[model samples]
Target chain A: MTLAASPHHILTVTVENKPGVLSRVAGLFSRRAFNIVSLAVSPTDDERFSRMTIVVDAESAPLEQVVKQLNKLIPVIKITEVPPAEGVERELMLVIVKAAAETRGQVTELTAIFEAKIVDVGYDAMTIMVVGEPEKLDAFSDLVKPFGIVELQRTGRIALPKLARESTRLRSVKTARA
Target chain B: MKLTGAQALIKSLEMEQVEVMFGLPGGAILPVYDPLIDSSIRHILVRHEQGAGHMASGYAHATGRPGVAMVTSGPAATNIVTPLCDAYMDSIPVVVITGQVAYSVIGTDAFQEADTVGITMPVTKHNWLISDAQDIPRVVREAFHVATTGRPGPVLIDLPKDVANAPMEWYWPEKVDMPGYKPNVKGHPRQIKDAAKLINEARRPVIYAGGGIMLANASNELRALAELTGLPAVTTLMGRGALPDEHPLCLGMPGMHGNFTAVTAMQKADLLITLGARFDDRVTGKVSTFAPDAKVIHVDIDPAELGKVRLADVPIVGDLRTVIDEMIKALKSERSKQDPPDLAPWLATIHDWQERYPLKYRQEEGGPLKPQFVIESLRDNTPDDCILVSGVGQHQMWASQLWKFKLPNTWVNSGGLGTMGYAVPAAVGAKVGRPDRMVWAIDGDGCFQMTAQELVTAASERIPVKIAILNNAYLGMVRQWQELFYEERYSEVYLSPDLPDYVKWAEAMGCVGMRVDTADDVVATIEKANEIDDRPVVIDFRTDWREKVYPMVAAGSSNDDIILGPEFGEGGR
Candidate 1:
């Protein structure tokens, strides 16, 4: 079987919500020399479990090896890979761009075009809260860079498997039966 | 049910049926020692924490039980890191307990405090830092369960001093609640069938048995499979005793220092039915050229090891014993449907290779004692079931090459990590674990110097483990490499023959010590050392330093390029 050619592989891992569990997962990646492109972790629906969204650079280590090694950790419950094409991924970025009176209208127009919200407005700067797919967020960041961004931060990325779609033929068959 | 955490910890050990533990007490662990005073479990106080860790590993290797070791935090904890790493690499089930500073002072760098959990996280299968006194029994249970299951490995439990001193209601944990830690013990039916189909189809199939066979107690299953198919088998270094060395189909060890036949069998095989063995670089030299045309059927308990190196055509994740049993049944059904492949030609080829490049050495009369000759003599003199342990170096290679291991759990050494100074303490623990069997540690002078002080513990405890030091007056393996690879520059590898005076050191440690310089005295000294049963014995054998382990595939070189000793004449290449 051929290895996944994608440089970035996103993995959703559920682990026991115990102290040091995060370090255990993080330690494993660092020691095994698997480069983590981005990581976002938070409590899951069940308080006893936590979900970790880890995006790893597959060029440094094979995705199969990374998953297998992570599974070996006692605290890790389940690991599911969310391929870029098969999953819904979102990233939130908060940027304080230099929006003077002249460029304020342009910044607000740009934010509206990107469907971003101005969470905090300063005398000379505006903190724009933009939430979208990582790629869209990257495009927005590039569009706002010309307005002289003062500070920027992205909340990494969180993902979930896309809902399964009903086949059109099956739907048509159900409709005919109805 | 009210008890201090120390008492609960000792009670937990008793519940686990732990017979003995190796450790030394310190201020942080003093409370734990108090409970040990009234405990039934025997605690063998060691000279150093490193000794304790290795002793625990040796016990595990010898008895097939998770070995127990306890040490204080900070320096003491750091001292045992080598053994923990060694056990991790070799997959020995060792449960180490370390005393930590008070929970409140843990980050304050209190006296004798260390982040034991953080330090050992990468090396252990799992580790815990117990904060609540009530968590003692469950954590202990989990530690043992994790350490002994799946691919067996070392685990640690760091108990804070305050926690150990705190009062707690003790109750035995009937079952472990590790939701995420379930080890797959049985093979998938499809994988098993696929493996059997490959086994039945290949004429040049080699049963590459590894340490997993012994760890899973599947030597009988291995023997059954090898006999059923008439397939030749090669055991790796860690897999030394999995198949009896004298078996007709056994091709001895296969690796960098492996025998010519074993190395060549793997290189020329059409199918490699690898069990419980990883495709380590040492075994498959320059993997790109290893078994160029072979289809691998890799079986291991750990799914991670399946495709870690060479991808397997059939990768079965299960305990070796269970997987092999399934494979045997599957093969029987397959064989009944179609005739088994004719392996006579393959066997004949292996036999020819074995005869042409048999392991050879020369020991002239009155000449300096050859290390291989000493190992052979020991093999001849020792009991059939004696447990032989060795430290890392040329002596370890020589011992692995020369000794005819006939029983499982009879050969122990630092195979993966190649830790020096493993022999003395490990032999002591092995003897303690198997009091019925004779335990001999074959050590090098350099290795002996590392942990030879453990002899004092053996002497004081009256554990009659025998040791034979192949004192070659140099770090022999490194010296050999310098000689061959560096134009004989001979840097800092030499350790003068009589510098520490091993005999005097042994006597000072309260043990009988003997020295043999000539070939004639070798057997006599060994025999005499064997007769002593009251206390530990150390025999210093001044061996010839010029000899090198042969049939070597140099680092990163292909197995096809195995270098034989001069005994092979012009065919040495």
Candidate 2:
């Protein structure tokens, strides 16, 4: 019997902050033909390293195999998969749309309703920034599309666990005096 | 002391104790080469950049040390891509240095420029592009460290011409500060205990070992564990000499061209304990049905390999030798005479498969020789420790199947990349690395033509490597595939039988050349080639083109679908 397709998985990978490390990771995904649904890369607290939160569809490729291949990369220090139930996820999107005098009021109302901010105002356009789950951004984009969107950019989904804990385990030495 | 970037690079290599390097020089790398005269390291100039890369891999395989290769920018770097991929696939430790155009003109497409880092990113374990000469020593240390540790593979370091010319202070780093690269060397205690428990209980157990054993130098531990447990061991092509071929417990190779006993034994086994082996697609014919009834225990230095293909019931991530040593100790602590698994029935079944489908070939009386006959004769004539290298093709499979590998690091081939033209250059490297031992390159006509020019380097340098060309007048492996899968519609697989004439070609390269057409002449030709140790030699053996490797499992098919050759006709004749 065929196993049920696994759900979307978020992998948090820590790697050395070197020039080609990003290309090495991205190249591995493309070469292996593993689809990355969303990706967010940023520096970690330690300047020497960076962390990438990669969202992948397990149905498209085996998650275990992806993890293994990622581990093979020399710069990759650690990788952990966060199930949807254990994590909170969010994405940020910036959209520049037509805001001619005729529809400026209506656009402002829509922005207010979505809790988006008017980051920039040009003669004929306004840039709105929104931060939320991927689905929320998709819905916002669809609603704004009718208003003649000029440009849009999205930071792929980034996530963290709901429970506070150490990011990685450190060896602990127990004392017998106590 | 202040030094130019090229001098700093040379000093860095010296710091790592690099004894020899294989390379070809050109405009971009000329600055680096100028410093070679003063360095203690020996440079063996190759005829081609690809030859230099494969030679480095061959040196690595023979010596169990990180081999080094250097080449110039653009085409020179592109030429070595095949060898880099080959080393990546087989986990051979090699560090390749490439010259680059000046850093200022990198993106502007200057003369003889290539995006070395981007082009080699996927094929290399790691790579670096030098921004300044001061980074040379630290980067060189890290390059060798990354190349030789964990699951060993090739690493690249690209040096810009401007950086090589720039002056800077050189200092060796006391330690490599790579926080992201720590390898797990010790298996988890609990996992070791579980593996030992499985070994203690498996009724029909099989030990499937791969190149990891050779890469880790764990042959002794593997042999000890196999004998102590009375488990049958089957090697993958890369894992050929993990155990001596004559060992009673050894079942030879297991895969498409693997022996019948080894292939069937794996399919019939109840427990498969894989050591330092990834379940490659070649080894596991059809993943769904392979070892369908067996529970797996996969141990490897790379954590991802354990469950990448087949799920491991007792997955242990650690160094192969250390894990095996731990396993033996755990088994010993829990040993009971009554607890050892009874393997007699399983051994008897394996014996039956061996008897029914022994690796076989027939020779027509007083006619052209078969490739198998040539390989068998070569095996009979060579010393036990003679290092054998093969290029990829029907000849590669035949060499893997027919040769008796009694020692580790003695069988070198392009296993992962399945590259053609690997034999001649690699044999040269092997001979250069082990000057006291004999090196023979068993290659096919199609594969031999790819990198045969490297024989000139071997001859000129006095490497004394021997070559045996199994001349079948075509790309035999592809022809076999077309015959079996494409209904015998042979396309452009043939290379003219008399083209360039191998004997004359070898002689022109300043080496002794001989041709053997009949089965009777094979041994004499080999003996004559073996006798000439002052220079390299090439022997062209005109073998029958019609013969195909037998006991074949067509790619992507289940092991159960193994096709026997005509020799095992209807009613198993």
Candidate 3:
């Protein structure tokens, strides 16, 4: 399933802190059309290198291009293209919706299906907290859309895709080989 | 004698330049959040804890960096499952740091207690539960190493509440000691020789480059290989721009949305060298009939990728760049020969296919806009080095179909994990990375609404990202399926009622926005959007609501089944 320019993908890169290293790496990402959702460069295990994670919602081809470009940067040690299904992913969302007496109960029920917790509640509206995958969150958000969702805030996506079982075994094998 | 767990985690992540995180605060993790207050790391507070995971995933994907998300124990930790599963299957590198109900309450089902490690075991690249304060530094360090190396996937470190808050003497490791994490960079010398032999012996050879080429940072190697072997190269979507488009030896994208010439060439090739690319369905059409007569040489970093679908004649395991270098050194250029003896007949057949089924679209008789027109407009307006992000569905297919993508990473879309609502925020991410290049979010109406809220992030960040919404008023891809296979029973596929007024919504989000109801307005609106200030821009192009994407091959069908637009004779009969 090819995702067109969708907001589902995210890229995170960590690199070395050196003069023009940021420019060199950033040059590669921008050169390849890889977008940076949230870019932060700071400290790492080694004061010499920094880690940067960006979110670009592209298909594998272009994202790979960006990664290759990043790898070319002398400061960039490694780059990865983290796909949604290959890892554990999450996004943060903040929704403010109407909470009239008539709609409050149904809203609560809807939020329950989405497993949204209420962070802040007001007579006129409520700020709900629901964190799940995008689909469930989306369904819940849509459910409340009819009830008048006034505002929404979603953090970009974060993810962790599990290793294949074979690699797990390989980890053992490498130790044996070593 | 003590450092905050958050500080330790920050210090650990700081070792990785931990700049951004997406998460929500809860009882068990309050202490961890407390230290975040003193740190410079910016945390985007999401409405739901799950969004934190996706936000991190999105951040990672857009920037080619690992994304991190933090959440409290039990349900908050569990809430991140869907994206975890999504990331697990799609191979996104995300680090999910979940706060547990303290080391003491781990198994008691205490308030907010859940086995996050057990729950995320199958979804993360690796999962570590640290109950000891002293382990946070090492665990976080290991997480970054595992998450972004080799085939790059997600990794997690679930910290207990007591552990996150526990005082630790911070000790940063000089190098991440990942005993289980060794990725192969150099290919086997013998295998490289065999690959050269395959290249030398092949009469009609085609090189298929995958995402691994990008992963190995081997585009130049790939190009060199293609040139050294005189083989025309076909790139998987993930391998897009493995070779510049203008290169004579380059065959454009190959897969479901690929060019007729590309698909036809792959079908007729006698020798197919597949590098870093998996035999994804979109690229193979139907497994049984795809390149039936070709001898496949598969090269990839991961050994499991060698024969998962289309078995390789020669399987080489190593980083693509190193392998290509080895092959270049070993392979003899003098041995390069012209395509097979009967190449003329095959080339003629492909040329015929190109003439028969050219990719095309007609504005619904009297309709105002065409989807292709919008994509082409952006392709023209965007700087040569600009990035174009796409949403899933017909628009993504259309962009792949119409966009003249000469370079890799310039086009961002979800491929293996066909996630919608990916383009907008991804474009925002891209703009954040490279503020100089123009970024466009090409999405269908059905997908735009999915992650539309991220527009606020783009607006707030002052990232000059532009969104081009192909307002087709339906989940165009599924609707096309319903139209073709289900006798046009549109079902719930129609999105007219649910679609938002994108122009107004963009304005509400504080973006410079407009709508394009006709072909003539496309260029102007895109041009106007480009001129906007340090804010995002939106253009909702009101295209014909119901139209079909052409050149579709039915599921489980062969390459012979491609339905070329009426113009093409046959997609290579």
Candidate 4:
């Protein structure tokens, strides 16, 4: 498959839970001039392994080249590309907006529409916790920019492959029977 | 039985059958040095850590085995960085062991503490910083395995001082179970079939061989395929000896300074069967215009190398030996159905190019010595099986162009990295690897000055490697570039011929030194140097500085724009 078709590529990399693995992976990206748009890492259910959700800008480097180079690292166990359409992805963002008394009502209504939670209330600002796909988070941030975001933190992205649909499973079963 | 981590490290190396290692001791690595006195592996103390690293690379290049190098941390670790990068670029197998500060003081910036692994992450194939003393054996085993497998590059192991001194039970791991590291050794059957079909259909085909053939020890298979299909092959600088120079189908080295026939053949071929050779910029010139008409069947062990610079019609990722064998069988089966394309016309075209623009030079009797003539004399006088190592420069290009390499593993140089000062130490390492074979390091005066101190190590270790310095008294390649492209604006290229008196320097280092200034003395000096067996010999051949390597493709230009030398009449295009 041609990897240059998409600008954004999400790779779920499984690596050994050894020391300096994160640095090695990050160093590889910087060394090869591959732009890492977003990256999140956490230990897997198996203590010996860790899973890294890496979102890369494919325009900076070809996705196939990035994947092949990552696979060569001895600590990396496996790399699976999670296509945006075929995978379920989420990002967590905490934004403190300038919601003074005059704009507090409007900000509350906007948060309700997006189903975001107001985790903290302050004199001049409200801290909103928004968890959704990267695209949804971007939309929320753009809308809140008029309210003046005082502080912002995005927990980059984490993803998993979507479950197969029941209809697709049924069709596969029928084909096997045939 | 319990043993120190350093002892376990030594024992593990012995288990891996490492006979010799090049290194020097320092404070951080002092613990590891203590056990070396009892170890069976012979350690050659080097004048510099860079020398140790290059020596290891030389040994690996000469013997086709992973070379070992050890050094202390901080500056020592940093010193070997060039060789590590060089090995990585050229896919040479070398395992470098660097001592680190004690585990407790690792982050405190204690004396002789540097993050060796972090600094070398991009250059090495793999690396490990030992955290536990008990993990020494497994890490050593993994380092050796990773360094020797797949594309085979340098690997590093940073051993902390505390870990080296800590107690641990030594047990050699029977099997390495690295889930992330499995090298594919067999080509897919379908890809093999497609490659064979392409081979059978092509009219003008050239076998583009590279260092990977020698790394895979598949030279025999390459020769078999070339002979079977009656195809002409062009070897890159790294692949010089993969196809013997005397072989009828061998078209010699092809690149910026390659012969006219080899470069033009690639530029004009209809198909290129690329075997273990990457489309390096030097060999390809301007990538967009490289072999514009040819369909490439690229095979490499590294998957990333395929479709990297140029797209391959059929990209086969596997070991070259197995892939070539499968291709041979597949070609034979396909031939049963239809005959291969006739290549007589293509062969004749290449022959004409070879005849019209062969590598040429001029040297009058009793006049100034020419570097090319000196190389020819050395090649004629040296043993047929001698291993010729070289530092990077005009001297290196001349050696690659002029030497008649008839065997694999005989021609060694820093091709991908173009590292200067690689010869003298590498020669010592090469001689150590194969003492029975004569090792000659052809170096330039500028290159010789960079690491000439390594001759002391060679002399002290009794390595009888001979060195022939093409003393042109300039950074010859750069000066040539300045002369041609920069309009004779020679800036900082000249190194005077009389600086430091090479004969006296060689004598001080306990080596037999000789000098030759005229054409008549070239062969006699080389013969006399070749006769020395007890110690190292250094021959300084003062040659004319005006000569430049020809059949040149100016950087960033098309290979079609190659300029033959002045011998080819005015404007020699």
TM-scores for the candidates: 0.97, 0.95, 0.72, 0.98
Candidate 4 residue spans exceeding 4 A from truth: A1-6, A167-178
Evaluate candidate 3 and give its CAPRI docking class based on DockQ: incorrect
Q: Candidate 4, residues B57-159: lDDT per residue as tens digits?
A: 9999999999999999999999999999999999999999999999989889898888898899989999999989999999999999999999999999999
Q: List the residue pairs that clash in candidate 4.
A: none
Task: Give the CAPRI class of candidate 4.
Answer: high
Model 4 lDDT tens row, A24-140:
899999988999888999999999999999999978998889998999988899999999888899989999999999999999999999999999999999999999987778888
Docking class of 1: high
Report DockQ per prediction, comma-separated. 0.84, 0.59, 0.01, 0.80
**10 residues in a row with least lDDT, candidate 3 chain B:** B334-343
lDDT of 1 at B65: 99
Please give, for residues B372-471, the per-residue lDDT of candidate 2 as tens digits: 9999999999999999999999999999999999999999999878999999999998988999899999999998889999999998888899999999
TM-score of chain B of 4: 0.99
TM-scores computed on chain B for all candidates: 0.99, 0.99, 0.92, 0.99
TM-score, ranked from best to worst: 4, 1, 2, 3
